[model samples]
Target: MNRFGTVVIGGGQAGLVMGYHLKRRGEDFVILEGHPRIGDSWRRRYDSLRLFSPPRYASLPGLPIPVDDCPTRDEMGDYLEQYAAHFELPVRAGVRVTRVSRDAEGFRVETDEGEYLADQVIVAGGSHAVPQRPAFASELDPAIRQLHSLEYRNPEQLADGTVLVVGAANSGTDIALEAVKTHRTLLAGRHPGQVPVDIDSGRGRMMLPIVMFVFRHVLTRRTPMGRKALAEREGHGVTLVRNKLADLDAAGVVATSRIESVRDGQPVTAEGDILPDVGTVVWCTGSGPDHSFLDLPVFEGGRVRHERGVATGEPGLMFLGLEFQFAVASGTIQGLDRDARYLLRQLRQNTVRSASRPVTVDRR
Candidate 1:
C-alpha cells in the first residue's frame, strides 16, 4: 500500500485527472487528499459562491458538470463526489502528505497516516493551497474581527459593524458585494480588470462562449498576448468573472485604492485617507501554492519552474493545476485534462526512456 508507481498529492480536479490518466496508462498510482472528502476545496468556500462558467465550462475531462446554469458550491462538491465515484479513482482521502523528499527509491512522501514510496510524484495540489493576506493586517486593533477569504464561509462569521474587504480579486469583490447586504462594506485595492460585458446580461451571455474560446484557445502560453498576460497577472488577479465593478458600484460598496496601512484604530488607504468604524477586515487578497512540504530547490521567483508541468530538477517529479500553469484556464477544471494528458505523456516517455537505459552496476 505504501509503494506506488506514482503518488499524486491532492484529490481535487487536478488529482482526479492525474488519477484518471495514470489508471488509463495502467500505472499503479494513488491520490492522497488532505480533506476527508473530495471537493472540500469548493465546499468550504464562502456560502453563496457560484461558478462564473456554466456547466459546460466548469466540467472535468469526460465528466460534465450537470448544472444548467452556473453551478453552486454544494453542487460542485456533489459533482466531485460523483466524478470520483464514477471514475473509481484510487483516492485515499484524509491522507495529508506532510513532507515530500527525493530518495534513491524515487520519492518518499510522508503522510499523517503513513509513508508512501513512489517512482514518480505529481504535486497535484489544487491552485489555492495558501491563503494570502497583508502583513499590516496583524497591526489592526485587537478588537477588530479579521478573516482570510478562505476562512470566510458566510457573513454570519462577521461582527455587527462595517466590513472592510481588501483586495479586488474575484473573491474580494464577491465577498464585498455579499458583505454589503448586511453590513457597510468598503473595498480597497487595485480592482482587477473587469470583463467588457456583463456575463449574466443578454450581451454578456452571448459573449461567454467568446470568452471561453479566448481563454481556452487564444490565451495560452504559446501566444504572445497570453504570455504577456501570464506575466502581468502574476501580481494581479484575473479579470472579474460572474461579478463586475458595475455590480459593486450598484451594490453601494465603496471602492478605493490599495490599503496603505492602519492608523488611529482604523483602516487607511493608499490615498492618505482613513477608514473609520470598520468592525471586520476580510483579506481576500489572493493565495499561492504551498510547496513548503516540497524538499526540492525547484522554486524560481516564488513559483515552481517547470516546462508545462514537468519538473526540471527532479526527473520523476511533476506538477499540475498551478494558476496559469500553461494557459489562462490551466488552473481550472476545464484545463486539468489538457495539462494532465501532457504531463502524462512526458512522464510515460521519461519512464520508458529510463527503463531502456543500460543499467550501470557500481561493482566497486
Candidate 2:
C-alpha cells in the first residue's frame, strides 16, 4: 500500500492530468491529496469566484467543461471531481504529505498517516498551497478580523465596517467589489494593469481565441516576450481580467497605495495615511511556491530550479501546475495537459539517460 512506481503529490488539476498520462502509460502511480474530496481546493475559495477563462478554454485533455460561459467555483470543483471519476484515476484522498526525502531507490515521502516510497515523484501540489501574509500582520489589533483570500468566502465573513483589501490584484478587486455592497471598501496596492477588453462581452468573447493563443504560445519560455514577462512575473499580480480599476471607482471602492505597516493596530498606507476604520482586512498579497517539505537540494533562492517541469538537480523529481512554468497559461486548466505531457517526456528522457550511463567503480 505504501509503495508506488510514481507518487503524484496533490490530486488537484495538475496531479490529475499527470495521473491521466501515467495511466495511459500503464504506470502504477498514486495521487495523494490532502483534501477529503477531489475538488475541495476550489470549493474552499471565495463563494463569488468564477474562472475568468471561458468554457472553451477551461477543459482537461479528453473532457470538455460542460458550460458555455465561465464556470463558477463550485462548478470548476465539481468538474475536477467528475474528471477524476470519469478517468478512474487512482486518487488517494486525505493524505497530507509532510516531507519528501531521497533514498537509494528513489524518494521517501513521509505523510501524516504513514510513509510512501516511489521511484519518481511529481510535486504537483501547486504554487498556492499556502496563504501568504506580511510579518507586520501580527502587530495589528486583535479586534480586527483578518483573512487571506484563500480563507475569504464572501462579504458575509467580514465584520460590519470598512473592509480594507490589501492588494489591488484581481482577487483584491473582486473582493473589494463584493465588500462595497455591504461595507465601505478600500482596495490598497498598485495593480499591474487590466486586460483591454471585457472578457464577458461579445467582442471580448470573439477575441478570446487570440488572447488564449498569446498566453499559450506567443508568451512562452521559447518566445522573447514570454522571457521578458517571466522576469517581471515575480511579486507582481497578473493584469486585471474581469474587473478593472475603473470598475472599482464606479462602485465607490476606494483605491489606495500599498499598506506599509501597522500603526496603533491600524493599517498605515505607503502614502502615510492610516486607515482607522477597517473592520476586516483581506490580504490578496499573493501566495508563493511552498516546497518546504521537499528535502532536496534542487532549490535556488527558495524556488525549485527547473527547466520547464524537469528538476534540473534531481533525476527523478518533477514539478507541475506552477505559475508561468513555461508560459502564462502554464498554470491554467487548458495548459495542464501540455505541461503534463512535456514533463512526462522529460521523465522518459531521464530514464533513458540513467539506464544508458555506465556505473563508476570505486578504487580500493
Candidate 3:
C-alpha cells in the first residue's frame, strides 16, 4: 500500500482548503474525491442559486473571489476550479472512500480504486452531502412526486398541481417562492427572521456591528431560547409568501405544529387535521451526520468530538469543515482557511514526532 503523511477525504471546499495548507507546509498528502470532476457539487445547484453572503466573504487560502457582489452558483464553481488549478493541489478524482479504519501503525482508508495508509486522516465532507427528509414522508404515495431540496433543480420539475413545502428554511422558502410562480404553492412551518440583503440606512449600519456581536457572543446552541429562535429563523433568506398565514389558515396551504403521520396518501397534522388532495410534497427538512464509513470511536453524542478540529480520543484522526468546528464560521469558505492552517500545523507536528520516534523490531 502507498503511504501518505495525511489523506483528506472529500474534495469540497473544506478538503481543498486543507490540501492547500498541506501543500504550503510541504507536507505529503493526497485529496480523495468521489465526483468525476472537482466543484461539480456547486455546479449542480439550481441555476438561480446565489451565495447567501457577498463575495467579499467567499475566499480560500492564497486566493480571493473576483467579484464583490453576491456570486452565482456557477461563478463559485468556476472560482473553485481555478483555485484548485492555481494551487496545483494533488487530488485523486473519482475515488470513493468506502471505509476508514485504524491499525497499530496508523489509518487505513479503503476506496474503490485501492487502499491507502496514512498517518493522519481528515474528513472534510461538509453537511450537505446528506440531504435529510422527514421520516413520515417515506410512506407517502410515490406517485405524489416527493423530492428533497437537493434533488430539486427548478420549479419546472414539480408536478402541475398544488404543492406543499415543508420546513421553511432557506431552501424550503426559496423553493416555495419559485414554485408559487409556476404552481399553486402552500408554505408550511414558522416564518424565519430576516434582514434586507444590504442595509443602507445609518441605523442599519450602526446595527450591523451590534448584530455581528450578538451573533458571535449571545446566540449559541447552549442558550435554550436563542437556539429555538435560531432554528425558527434558519431559512430567513427565502422571502415570505405575500399571502398572510391567517389568510391561508391551513386551507390553501396549511401550517401545522408538526406532521403527525401520513394516512391513505395524505399528511395528518399533530392537530388531527389531514391534508388531502395534495399533489406533491417537498421536504426541506435538515440533514444529519453520516459517518458510517468511519470505524473509530471518535464521535460523541451524535457529533465528532474534537479539540480545535483534531479528534481528541483518536489521535491522527481529524475532521475539517464541520459546522462551527472551531469558530462561528468554521465551515464556510471564509472560515475554512484558518481552520485548515491550524489542522495543517497539527498534522506537521505529528509527522515530526512520528519520524523522530524510534521504531523497534519484534524478536521471536
Candidate 4:
C-alpha cells in the first residue's frame, strides 16, 4: 500500500490549506480529491454563482484570489487550480474515498483506485456533502420539475412555469433572485434576515475584517455568547449576502411562510395557503457532511469528536472545515489560515509526546 505521513481527504480549499501547512513543515502528506480536476466543485456550481466574500476575504493562506472584484464561480475554480500547481501540493485527483478506518499502526484510507496507509488522516470535505431535501418532495406532482440548490446550474435548466424556492438562506436568496429573471418566482420560508448594508459599501468593507476577527477570536466554543449562537444557528442558513428583501420585492418574488405540507399534491404553507401553480420546486434547504464512510466512533451529538479540528477520542485522526469547528468562520476560506496553523501546532505536540515516550528494547 502507498504509505504517507498524512492522508488528507478532499482536495478543495480545506484540504489544500492543510496540505500547505504540512508542506511548510516538511511533512510527507497527500491530498486525495474525488473529482477529476482540482476545483471542479466550484466549476460545477451554477453559472451565475458568485462568492459572498470579496477577493480579499476569499483566499488561501499564502495565495490570494486573483481578482479585484467579487469572483465568479469560474474564477474561484481557476484560482484553486492555479494554487495547487504553484504550491506543488501533492494532490491525487480522481480518487474517491470510500471508507476510512483505524488500523493497527494508524489508519487505512480506502479509495476507488486503491488503499493508502497513513500515520494520520484528515477529513477536509466541507459541509456540502449531500443535498438535503424534504421527504414530501417525492409526493410532488410528477410533472413539476424538482431541483436542489446543489444540482441547479442555471435558469435554462428549468421548464416554463412558476418556480417555488423553499428556504430563504443565502443560496436560496441568490437562486430566488436569479429565477425571477426567467420565471415567476415565489420564495417560501421565514426570512433568516439579511446583511444591513451592501457588501461593497465602505462601512461593509470596514466591517468585514472586524466581523472575521469576531468570528475567529471573539466568538468561540469557549464563550457563552458563542455557545448560544452556535446552538441557535444550527441547521439554520447563512445571513443574506449581496441580495436583500427589497431586491426580492422589486423583482416581484412573493415571500411566504414555510411550507408545512403538500395536500392534494399542492404545497400548503404554514398559513394554510395552497400554492397550486408552482411547477418547479427548487429546494434550497441546505446540506450536511456525509461521515458514513468514516469507521471511527468519533461522531457524537451530530459533530465529530474534535476540539479545534483535532480528533478528541481518536488519536492521529483530525477533521477540517467543519462549520464552527473553532469559530464562526471555521469552515470558510478566511478561517482556513488560522485553523491550519493551529492544527499544525496540535500535530507537533502529538509528535513530541509520541517521541518522548521511552522505548523498551525487547531481548529474546
| Count of clashing residue pairs in every prediction | 0, 0, 3, 0
Model 3: weakest 10-residue lDDT segment is: 235-244
- Per residue, candidate 2 scores C-alpha lDDT tens digits across 143-209 of 9999999999987799978899998888988899999998999989887799999999999999989
lDDT for each of the candidates?
0.83, 0.87, 0.72, 0.85
> Which digits, one per residue and each the tens of the lDDT, describe model 1 over residues 84-176?
999888888888888898766568899899888777889998568688887888789989999999899998998978898888888899899
Better TM-score candidate (2, 3): 2
Assess the local accuracy of residue 183 in candidate 3 as a C-alpha lDDT between 0 and 100: 69
Off by over 4 Å in 3: 196-257, 348-353, 356-364
**RMSD of each predicted structure:** 4.2, 4.9, 5.6, 4.2
Candidate 1 clashing pairs, residues 3+ apart or interchain: none
- Per-residue CA lDDT of model 4 for 261-353, tens digit only, reads 888888889989889778899999988887878888998897678888898878788888889888888878888888888877777655412
* Residue 345 accuracy (lDDT) in model 3: 73
Give the Cα-based TM-score of candidate 3 against the true structure. 0.83
Residue range with the least summed lDDT across 10 consecutive positions in model 4: 355-364
TM-score of 1: 0.93
Pitting candidate 1 against candidate 3, the one with the higher TM-score is 1
lDDT of 1: 0.83
- Stretches off by above 4 angstroms in model 4 are 349-364
